[model samples]
Target chain A: MKIEDKKRVLREMVLHRRFEERCYQAYIERKIGGFLHLYPGQEACCNGVMEAARPGHDYVITGYRDHVHAIKCGADPKEVMAELYGKETGSSKGRGGSMHIFDVAHRFMGGYALVGGPFPLAAGMAKAIQLKGGDEIAICFLGDAANNQGTFHETMNMAALWKLPVLFVCENNLYGIGTAIDRSTAVVHQHKRVAAYNIPADECDGQDIEVVYEHARKAVDHVRSGKGPYFLELLTYRYRGHSMSDSRGYRSREEEEMWKQRDPIFILRDRLIAAGEMTMADYEALEKETDAYIENEVIRFAEESPEPRVEDLEKYVLAERETQLPWLTGKAA
Target chain B: MAQIMYWEAIQRAHDEEMARDPLVICMGEDIGVAGGTYKATKGLYEKYGPLRVMDTPISENGFTGLAVGASFLGVRPIVEIMSVNFAWLAMDQMFNSAAKVRYMSGGQLAAPCVFRSAGGAAHQLGAQHSARMEKVFMGIAGLRVVTPSNPKQAYGLLKSAVRCDDPVFINEHELMYNMKGEVPDGEYFHPLEGSEIARSGTDVTLFGYNISVHWCLKAAEILDKQYGISAEVVDLYSLSPLDRDGIRKSVSKTHRAVIAEEDEAPVGVGSEVIAIINEECFFELDAAPVRVHSALVPQPYNHTLEKAAIPDHEDVVKAVLKMFGKA
Candidate 1:
């Protein structure tokens, strides 16, 4: 990877990490409500894959551990935070909370809440792109557990058979809720599972942003070249519990500490400092700046953003209910 | 104009829509080469080819989600389930994703998708297949539920559903598919979310939809000929955006009402109709509205038992007579 690209990936990943960490604090303080799925430990997977694709051209869809992906995909932080705060000025006008962040203009279809649901959607989006004579690819981000889902096979078959432009990136964090990948599936190597569909597959170190970005770029290039769908299994771990309410009795404290030792953000920061590209003071200054940025967004999201009006609930249900049709003249008996 | 069966009209609508628009496509099990279990999508694959007409594995949830996503990206997808019984597999996508996408997205997205399935009792198909679950969909906010009784209405409503920017649930009666009716040639669009008064009268009002509409019409004809009672019949083609005003208008003139439904009596479409009438036209009604519906029991597998379970022409006439105190 180029030096500039590496630096940019590191910066974005750091920003995402700090943003989520601060979100956790705000969540506890009762500022940001609803289900908050922290993506702190999985920052590399998001930044790495996002950096590989061309924004505003290629589409990205993922599961609910999504704030990082939204930020990395170029959604304004303030608007995303505002959405988390359930403000009318939010991205989905506060109708969609943390789980359903969508920006059509930016090509981020959404962060769907249902597990394994986004796979088929990504396949369909790829089909649409192919039908429209576009080379743009769709990157589907899912967890390790999603690989065992029936939709995974169904969508992979469709994508391969149709040769749709889609890259399936599974962030293998080992555990889905409480069930570890080994206990959940017979085949632990999720990348090899795509082999049944005859799609080429690869694996990457999701903890290393540069490694993930390089592999993602190659896989995306293959899909864009009309080589059909490709699967990339990113080996990673999450430092936090699955959700705010999870006690995480399934995994040990030692296991969590071990994963934290290889934290993507800290590792990347150390790499930059060791290479003399960035100093300790420079890293401190960057963290302070990100903290200020998050603080301002929280204040704006809480104070200035309006709650959605009660009447607005009924507005978007139907496209045009008022346009009368000729055959609608009374009831038939 | 041409006379065709209701199922044939549905197939024609899908064929015409696929031919007219490149984005319009069909996806479902047995819909490709088998041409749908009931032949509703017959000859679609031959004309549109495999790319437009897709044969999916029996993963209703997956394909339904695929259709929803495709709709979000500007494709008008017509998803067929072999039977409405199988639709329960995809209801999560239907209720959560497809129906709620437009509202949840706050108008940023619209799910212009149609889910068509054969519903209601047909012979001895048994309890599993004999579900008049259109009422369940009617309760959902964003979905437009339509049940067309004849070929003309089927074609027009289906064409409108394919073109509409909302998720439409079209319930077709398996038994009524072969019944022929007149359908106009060339481009035509029927209005969804509206009702149609099939037979106009002055004495009493009869409300029915889908298969029951035919029975109600037959009953009205019988009452007009055998007795002096001229009963008006109203077909609630669309259930969600129900034409309450139209029902009220008919009830005001007739002063008496009878609601006929193919489903079980309690909490059925009849209950909703009765509630609406009581709320809207209480003063206009001469007697409390009568509900003629299927018995509250699992649909029996025996042909005779099944026939007795669902409402028929005789049942409709009996209900009207009872309402008039002439039984």
Candidate 2:
């Protein structure tokens, strides 16, 4: 990566962390509501993989911990924040709240709420690409626990069978809500399980963004070059509880502190600063700029945005098939 | 017009649509090389080749979700669940994902995929297989549920469903595949909403859909000849919207109604029709509308018991006669 790209990526990691922290603050301030899943420690997984591929051309989907992924995929930070606030200007027009942020223009397919539900969808997108004879590949970012979903096994087999262009990036945060990988999954190592489907797999330390970016390049090449689906498991940890409701009583404090010591943001930022690629003043300046932008621009847009109008409550039910809701229309009953 | 079997109509629709747009594809177990179990997708695998005519494994949820996901990117995939019974495994994809994608994504995305499944009891397929799942699909909000009574309807509805820019669940009947009717020689797109007045009448309305539409027609024949009762057969093809205006118009004209369905009364097609009648045309009703539904039990395997378990033309006739106080 070029020096400029390295510095930019380091700044993106910091921006992602600050954006999520602002979301946590907004949740407490009653500015945002509904189920919010924040990605604090797993920044490298989304950034590293996405950086290796074209953001607006390629497809990206994940399971609910989506704010950062959408932003990284070129979704407007204001629009994402407005979606969390359930505003009319939100990404989903305030229909999906936080779990369903979508930017079709950016090719961020969506963030589905169901665990492992995106498995087949990713394969399907790849199949479409193959049908159209396009070079774009579909990438699905899901937690390690999502691998246990039946779609996981079924999709892997089909992707391999058809040689569909898709990359399965699993962020192994060690737990599915409260259940540990050992208790929930048979094979603790997620990449090894892909052997059953003959898919080439790799594992890397997710906290290290540079390592993630390096391995992800190979994975992206393998899938985009028509070698079929590739699985990349990034071993990372979450800083906060699973959701706002999670007290996180199930995990140990010592383990949390241990993982935090290897924080992905700090790792990338410190490395860039020590290499003379970025000065301490530059790092502090970038952090302050990102903080101000999130506070003044993203949050302010969300706070000042209007609520979705009531007339649109029944819209989007069908594309153009039924212009009106059957019941609501004067012609129906 | 060309006389064709119901399955042939479905096949022709697939061929026409696939030829019309290269984006349209078919996926299901046993649909490619072995042909579909009902032959609804026969010979297309050789014509369209592997990618377009995909024969998937026995993972209903996987392929169904996969097809819906493909629809997001402008690939129109028609997924055939071998049986509606097997579709139970894939309802999450159908109801939660395909149905809700457009609305949840705030119109930025659309899932224009069509899911076809053969349902209803046919020659004692056993309790598990003998499912009338139209009610389940109809209850969903984002999906458009349509059932075809004959070859003409099967062809037109499937074609229209493919062109439709929304998720549509075509609930086909296993018994109707071999049944024949005249289909138009030219391209035809059936309306996805409203009921079809299968037969015109004045004294009573026989409301039904899919297989039940045939029973209503048969019963209407018996009522016209034997009982001299002019019973109108209203084909409630659009189950999701329930054709409220068409249903009310028929019921108001007839002054009485008899809803015939293969499903049991509770929370099924019969119950929904009755609710619409009561809410829309209660004053037009001269007497209480009666429902002719199957016995409230899991369909039996034995031929004799199965015959007793399901509602047929005779039940529809009885329902009409009783409604007119001539039974």
Which candidate has the highest TM-score of all?
Answer: 2
Candidate 1 residues lying further than 4 Å off, grouped into runs, are A320-333
Q: Write the per-residue lDDT of candidate 2 for residues A94-148, one digit (tens) a residue.
A: 9988899999999999999999999999999999999999999999999998998
What are the models' TM-scores? 0.95, 0.98
TM value for model 1: 0.95
Residue pairs that clash (backbone atoms under 3 angstroms), model 2: none
- DockQ for the candidate 2 complex? 0.53
TM-score of chain B of 2: 0.99
lDDT per residue for candidate 2 within B1-327, as digits (tens), equals: 999999999999999999999999999999999989999998999999998999999999999999998999999999999999999999989988999999989999989899999999998799999988888999998899999999988998888788778899999999999999999898877777888899999999999899999899999999999999999999988898788899899989999999999988889887888898899999999989898988988999999999998989999898777777888
